[model samples]
Target: MTLYETIFTRRSVRQYDQVQLEASVLAEIRQAIDNEKQLPGQNARFEIVNADRLKGVAAPHAILAYSAGTDAALANIGYTLQGVDLHLQNSGYGSLWMGMGKPIEQSADYRILLAFGKTSAPLRAGQGDFKRKSATEISNEDNAIARVARLAPSAVNFQPWKLDFSPGKVVVRPDGGGIRKLLTGNLQKIDLGIILKCVELALEREGKAVTALTPKGGGKTFAVEVAFE
Candidate 1:
């Protein structure tokens, strides 16, 4: 499947076959990581490690994502590694965003993990297979961008973002307050990055590019404002 098609079919696979990944497949994954550009202005790192290096994850392979403890680091990793996640799924491997998994190599920089390998789980047949928020709920208008962004996976599936459209801009913001806010404070930022990737992909398919991404000064809640030219 194409990467774009994989976005519609991908599922978070937790159970994996108990076998090591072939060297050829592992090399392709590594190449995908190496070729991928990091999120602009973020210093995130990616590495493939044995499942033994991660705690509580049963997948035979794990991609340990590391980043400096900067404000945008976690979200950047989410945005960057998600490409590899989709690529793996397109290549017939299973992948899961390991937000809660612990790494054996203790480092302050280790931000998140993606457990991936052969699996028994099935990819969805199409976008209709996803249990996602409607486009109208996630954005100002139910356009193509909002429709795809609605499929972005988030922490606890909270879908904690709202897209507002202007003349030449698309503003993404955290949605909700109280316990939900506290529950997904940092994770929602990462969630925003995931949604941004979906927006980028959707726009790219229509021959548009993000002209700029500026961090709006409202602390961590409203992470970024994206302009498309």
Candidate 2:
């Protein structure tokens, strides 16, 4: 399956049978993880754990845990993790971003988990039918990329970023209010990067080309512009 198809078809799977990932598939995943760790601006690392190792942990059937040392690192980890997830889905495997606090001993200061396995059953009715907010709902201006960004996953599905579009520039800010408090700091920003990557992937699939500029400012509250050549 193509990466675009995987993006559209992938969904969170929580159950699995007694099955082991094929050696080739496991190798591909390991290679991808290695490449992601080498990517600049992120200190993310991943490990594949056997079912026995996950017995008492809050992890999924087979777990791949990604970790970093800081909030900034965590954000980068999220982006890289999603990219790997999309790639895995395209390769005919299913994956879900497992939530944190699943009971695990960790030396790293920051961490996230993803569970992988074949879908126990076919896609049920409305399995991939989740809806995203309209452009106007998420941003006032027309941001094709930000629209895709809105589809990025978050901890418990809590999307907590707001975009302000200016000519050749898109400003991003935290929308931490009531329930949004659940998503804060690096997790929120990292999730934003993941969504941005998805938007970029989707746009590329449609044959539209865009150049993403570095986020403006130094910290929190930045901008990413999608410039069409």
Return the TM-score for each candidate structure.
0.93, 0.77
Question: How much is 185 displaced in model 1, in angstroms?
Answer: 3.3
Could you tell me the C-alpha RMSD of candidate 1 in Å?
1.6
Residue 108 error, candidate 2, Å: 2.6
Off by over 4 Å in 1: 218-221
What lDDT does each candidate get? 0.81, 0.59
lDDT of 1 by residue, 1-229 (tens): 6666678999999899999998988998999988766666876888899878888888999998877755467667777887888888988889988778878779877877889999879899888888888999989988888888789888888888899987778888778567877886767777777787777787777678888866564554556687887
- Write model 2 residue lDDT over 100-200, tens digit each, in one string: 53424555443656777766644324324656665566676656666566766676666766767666545555554554664454556666656656656
Write down the worst ten-residue block by lDDT for model 1.
214-223
Candidate 2 segments exceeding 4 Å error: 35-40, 55-71, 101-103, 123-128, 183-186, 206-228
